[model samples]
Target: MQSKDLLQLAEQFGSPLYVYDAEKIKSQYNRLTKAFSKVEKLRINYAMKALSNVAILELLRDMGSGLDTVSIQEVLLGLHAGYSPEKIFYTPNGVSLEEIEEVNAMGVQINIDNLSILEQFGAKHPNVPVCIRINPHVMAGGNTNISVGHIDSKFGISIHQLPHLVRIVENTKMNIVGIHMHTGSDILDIEVFLYAAEILFDAARNFKNLEFLDFGSGFKVPYKKDDIETDIEELGKKLSKRFNAFCTEYGKELTLIFEPGKFLVSEAGQFLVKVNVIKQTTSTVFAGIDSGFNHLIRPMLYGSQHHIENISNPKGKERFYSVVGYICETDTFANNRRIPEIKEGDILSFRNAGAYCYSMASNYNSRYKPAEVLWLEGQGHLIRAHETFEDLIKNQISLPLPAKV
Candidate 1:
């Protein structure tokens, strides 16, 4: 998308809005699919938690992508987006056994991460197929906050307890269908990820009924210019060769599955916020935007860096400014970042805003959430409307104001 296009979106949808480039999303989906094209049975499940707009989900679904959902609501969102139960993979961590069973009843894939839940669910419904999530104790991701395969991470069942896991499977006679492992997001080292894949392969050897090996995706996309990211082409070439060999050894060509969220939509999304003020302090220049951490919290929550551009003035002189938001708390986006000179009312485009941006938005400070637009085929369609005052109070039960007492 061009800078002028983004500026036009801001003009049409107003500032503090999310605009997703459909073509970028399509290209990303195709890039990932092509990476593993050698695999006989490959499945790409878009992790809907990244950006769960129904339009985006449908776009992926049209391209034959399944969904990787965490919550029951996400699963429902997939269904609402017209995905079949068979196309949805549910891998909930620290959720209730009842919820697992509920999703199981819906005929979606069930992936349990803990021994207790696995045992309980298996003992109750051994006939249903299940997937086991294993923590390989690998830290390939860039940040601990987003990484889940570390030793102390609370995501998957530790690999050290494989014996106990096998025992539970044996005791309950559960049909194991897949093995899954997610080391976390923004994978820093491809070697570490491949090492984790070996762990998953070894775990898969224990189950003869397995139909697939889901190497949970943490593949990184470039966040900024010249930033390091997961080399998908190289990783795919290496892992695909090893995966085919493993399938041969297993005596069955098992499906290769990945659940990628950020890789599919992160670069495709652009968050547009207008500069509300340019404060010149004694020693620092602050460019305050109309939005805050409530809309994009990755910087505050994960210390993520989203390359910001002054789309309104692409050729302006370079200047150092501290980008901030209007939230009451210290909502610092970037500190002393060098970008093009920004003026009041200048539209700032935050790159890599597709994933984990709107999905993580909140209504803190009772502020209205921004609208969402899908830029498809050179047109910007409003996918979601900006929240109204009624939306804020729609769920709250109002009384007679305590009779003025």
Candidate 2:
């Protein structure tokens, strides 16, 4: 999709809208799959936490993608999107064992990261297969905020506790079907990631009946011009060879799996919001937009930079403007960002918004959530409607109070 297409979407769907390109998503999926085509069995479980829109899920499902869900609701969402229970992998953290059991009852694949729940579930249901998410204690991601494999991160079971993990599995007679690790997002060093893979491989040696090894995805996507991205092709070549060798040593061919969220969808997303005001402060010139961190919090939360373009006037002379949001709080999307001159009411498109942007949005300050459009086959399809007042207060009830204590 082009800047003109995004402008058209903003006109049709209104400002502060989300538009995802179906063709971009397709090419990304195809590219990742082709990179690993040499593997006998490969599985790409689209991480639903990134962008859980039903339309997006359905699109990935149609592409023969499985789902990597962190919550029971997401597992159910996968089912709703035409995925079978077996195709869904539930990898929740810090949740009660009851919730995990509930997901398992639906026949979804179970992935446990903590010892307490692993032992609890194993003892209760020894026959049910489980995957263990291990912390290799290797930081492969770009930012510390997004990196999860460090020693202090609360994401996975520590590699040092393998003996204890094995003991629990042995005593419970649990069926161990898979081993997994996720160092973090935006992987920078392929060698560092590969080092973590070796750790996962070592961890896998403890389980003999493993069905697959999930090297959790943190592949980086370019957010701005000339920004570096993960080389999936090179990583695939090296990792595929290692995986095949491991399979030969283990006497079986195990499925290679990646739970990629951003890699598959980040570039496909574009956020369009109209310039609401041009506030000239003592020190800064603010180009305030109709949306805020409530709509896209990555900038404030993780210092993520989404390439902003003045789509309304792409050829206008460039100028530096601090892009601010409408939220009451200090929701600054960009600080002194240089772009084509932005005028009031001009539509600005934020690139690399497909993943983690819309999924993390909230009704903060009670501003209604915006609509979402799917750009497919050169046509814009409304996937989600802009929220109304009814939607904002749908779950709330007012009570007449003249208190009786």
Per candidate, the number of residue pairs that clash is 0, 0
lDDT of 2 by residue, 255-324 (tens): 9999999998999999999999899989888999999999999999999999999988999998889999
In candidate 2 the C-alpha lDDT for residue 205 amounts to 89
Model 1: residues >4 Å from true position, as ranges?
Answer: 401-405
- Give the alpha carbon lDDT tens digit for every residue of 1-405 in model 1: 899888888998898999999999999889888898889999999999999999999999999999999999999999999999999999998899889988988999999999999999888899999999999999767787888999999999999999999999999999999999999998868899889999999999999999999999988899888999888999889999999999999999999999999999999999999999999999999999999999999999999999999999989999999999999999999999998999999999999999999999999999889999999999999999999999999999967665655
- Model 1 clash pairs? none
Candidates in order have lDDT scores of 0.94, 0.93
Residue 195 lDDT (model 2): 92
